[model samples]
Target: MTLFTVDPATVTPAPFTDDDWAFTLLRCLASPSTEEYPPARLCGFLFLAPDRLRLYFGTEPDLPGTTAADVRPGGALTALLAALPSLLDEQRLTKTDTDDPHCSRVVDLTGW
Candidate 1:
């Protein structure tokens, strides 16, 4: 299985809140496409974490290299939040006492 890990250090959590983080991956899943990304479909996970995440992507043929950067959050989560309410169940975040990590539900998007 391919692995796409997202370290909290990579994401500057200065904008959104921990509660609203779940929405980020959903955003990515809905419209996860950058200039370099191929027009392939994206489907993955919304793994919760107090800090980082692992966005697993299953790319189709003609596309080989898929990474965490390929996943989207804002738009994807919005759409999903509206549809899959059950996915938003409350879960304790994995916060480290040392540096108060951005406690939030993480999404691991795969294939977009």
Candidate 2:
């Protein structure tokens, strides 16, 4: 698993509310990447605390590994998020079907 710690102060508009945090997260995850290859697929949980936010990426259902800049909030964070989804694609990782119930349950829950 990979953990990304974000400093709230650096995030523009500063996520002060639950809704704001959700929106910021979605926006970052949906932002466009500046890469020519596809981004990696991220499957994990997001933990929001009173002081900061944590993005925990798991290595199941999909391969791991992602590249990011300094990840300063705002633009840099968005770029990093956008780049994650295309990592596996860029590496030409193949998606295989699984029969494990636990794995299937995870995939179903995450809709990955």
| Lowest-sum lDDT 10-residue window in model 1 | 94-103
> Mind giving the per-residue lDDT tens digits that candidate 1 earns over 2-111?
99899998887776764466555546555655555534334444343543344433344533433222123333555543433222221232112322122223323323
Q: After superposition, how far is residue 98 of candidate 1 from its true place, in Å?
A: 28
For model 1, the stretches where C-alpha displacement exceeds 4 angstroms are 1-15, 32-40, 46-48, 63-112
Report the lDDT tens digits of candidate 2 across residue range 34-102: 444323323333333442333333443354332221122333344445454444233222323433322
lDDT of candidate 1 at residue 75, scale 0 to 100: 39
What TM-score do all the candidates reach, one by one? 0.31, 0.29
